[model samples]
Target: MIVNLSKVISELESGSRPKGGVKDGVGSIASLGAEHLESNGGFNFKKVKYVPDEFFRSQSKGIIRSNDILIVKDGATTAKVSFVDDNFPFKEASINEHLFRIKVNTELAIPKFVFWYLFSNYGKDQVLSDFRGATVGGISRAFVDKTQIPLYSLNEQKRMVKLLDRADAFRQKRKQAIDLLDEYLKSVFLEMFGNISFNPHGFNIGKIADLVSEVKYGTSAPAIEKGKYPYLRMNNITYSGEMDISNLKYIDLAEKDEGKYLAREGDLLFNRTNSKELVGKTAVYNFTIPMAIAGYLIRVRTNEKALPEYISGYLNSLHGKQTLMAMCKSIIGMANINAKELQSIKILMPPVNLQEEYSKKIKKVHNLKQKMLNQSEELDNQFQALMQKLFS
Candidate 1:
């Protein structure tokens, strides 16, 4: 049977916080935002924010419960969904204005079944098809209410969920392996260089400007679906210091502007403007072909004093993140770390040969990671196919 999503849903409302917003670790009640919603249909509390106990008690709506589905309501990651499972760590939690809390009517449909359906490609397309706004996109409750859902028997829904759960677990294992490798690299870096923040090795300290031959910002050119060259945006650089060109747009630059805006091999790309948690993301450009970068990113060419890999690794480390968080200035909702500010931050300068050795080790790890990523993609494709067959 086909029906509007509103039929199966008992409650649908977005959350709200007190004016001036919540603070990190300020209160006992966990306050989830869009960032807490993971792409894998789960929550990520790696950086948890909180709401005051008194304020949480005052609100009647937005109170989180097990088996509830959450979706990002606005901004760049609009329509992202996550399910609050029984294993959720927080006993009392509420979401901020950026997320919508969904309660399913158990008698009509299963919560996880609805979550899986909304998380599917077909459902995502439906949700985003009516996406409104220019600078910050969002969807209203009307859109969610009108979305079509495929209804199935409780037994059939359970059967499909069982199959999907197994496939998702397999895919998650591969992702966990990749995460472990990243942790391994962090350990290796600590073992070799110690913590740069403490200057444990007594290495010479130098500002970023001293170690870089050039620091230049990217172009403000408009990107299209297809153009002469691939366009690199702030999102291209992952929080873990890796380049993700998979979701790339393209741009065409004038002859004179090409040399100014394009990123060459071995250059370090820095995301200068983003949310407080994501600002200062750094990655080394290893691709042979040059790509034009957007205005929000800055390209740095390392001098003989430092390697791009070493700098990127340092910036992606725990200490590096702390440093960035301290120095960055928040403007409106976004944080900014311009070229001048980035160039002034000091770094521990290790020996040239040591930096080269770290680079070589990282290369090997990246090769292995790429292979695993390929396998993960294949698994994900299969999972999506299964969903299409079942939900279509």
Candidate 2:
């Protein structure tokens, strides 16, 4: 049955509207933000926050108990969903101003079942439709209340959750395999190239300009939600030198930008503007699809002397990032290591043949990694399909 969230949820409350009233540095309370919501479920303690326990104890902020569904209500990450299940660690946690708490009435709905629904495509579409604002959008309490949820019998809901949980487990294992292969590649790079910091191989060193044909900035095109061309943003490149394509955005390229900021396969992307901590992130354009990059990024086209993988890996390496960060200029609020400075940075140049050999070896592992990625993509599509069918 299709029913408003107000029907299924006993209460819907927004967290503190303007957060940060609570003092930090207090270990007793763990403050929860939209970032805590992980893909699988629950909180990610890897990047958690601590607030004063007094606030949580006094019930000043919205304290989330087990089985509460958390939804983000503001900014770019608006509409993100998380289920705070009993297994979530921490004796107490409170939501910040940007989140909302939805307590399901156990008599009417199952928390995990409802969580999987809200995490589905249908749920996100509904949330996005309700969002209001010109710049940074927001979800109001009334809008969320008016949001509809598809419900089923309790037994049917339980069975659906059980099946979805099993599917998620398989995806988790696939992710683990990919992580292990990545680790193996790291080891191989270390064994062949040695530490970039130590330079034990005595390779000849020269400015990066000698190894690249062009270092050009990307397009400053206005982006759209739906477009003909896939686009890369600063956030698409991870600090570890891998592309996170799961959340890629698209923009219709203008006539002038069609070929101006186009990224070809084997091109290396460098984030030229960001916070000091995340600036200088680099990733290879390994995907075959034609895509455009944002102005905040720089594209480096390497000469025959250097492979794109080699250059990308080198820049992503601990030493490579440190070198870039050291040379960047922080002005206004963004950091930049423009084309000129990037070309001047000293780089270790080993024999191109050695880099080719390493690339060939890594290709075998990448093939398997690609297979896993395909399988995971298929699984996600199937999961969403089933979810939509059940809910619709």
Q: Against the true structure, whose TM-score is highest?
A: 1
Which of the numbered candidates is closest to the native, going by highest lDDT? 1
lDDT measured at residue 351 in model 2 versus the true structure, 0 to 100: 97
Q: What is the lDDT of candidate 1?
A: 0.91
lDDT to native, each model = 0.91, 0.80
Instruction: Summarize candidate 1's per-residue lDDT along 327-389 as a digit string, tens digits.
Output: 899999999999999999888899999999999999999999999999998988888888999
**Residue 78, candidate 1: C-alpha displacement in angstroms:** 3.4
Candidate 2 C-alpha lDDT tens digits along 1-392: 88877788787876552244555455577777777776655567766667665556666547888888998888878888888766888877788777888888989889888888888989888877788898988888876566789878999899999998888778778877877887787777777887756789988888789899888888887788898888889999986677777777788876876767889888889998998768888888888888889999999999989998887767766677688778888888788878888788788888999999887887787788888989888887888898888788
**Model 1 stretches astray by more than 4 angstroms:** 23-26, 128-137, 197-202, 221-227
Clashes of 1: 0
Error of 2 at 89 (Å): 4.1
Backbone clashes, each candidate:
0, 0
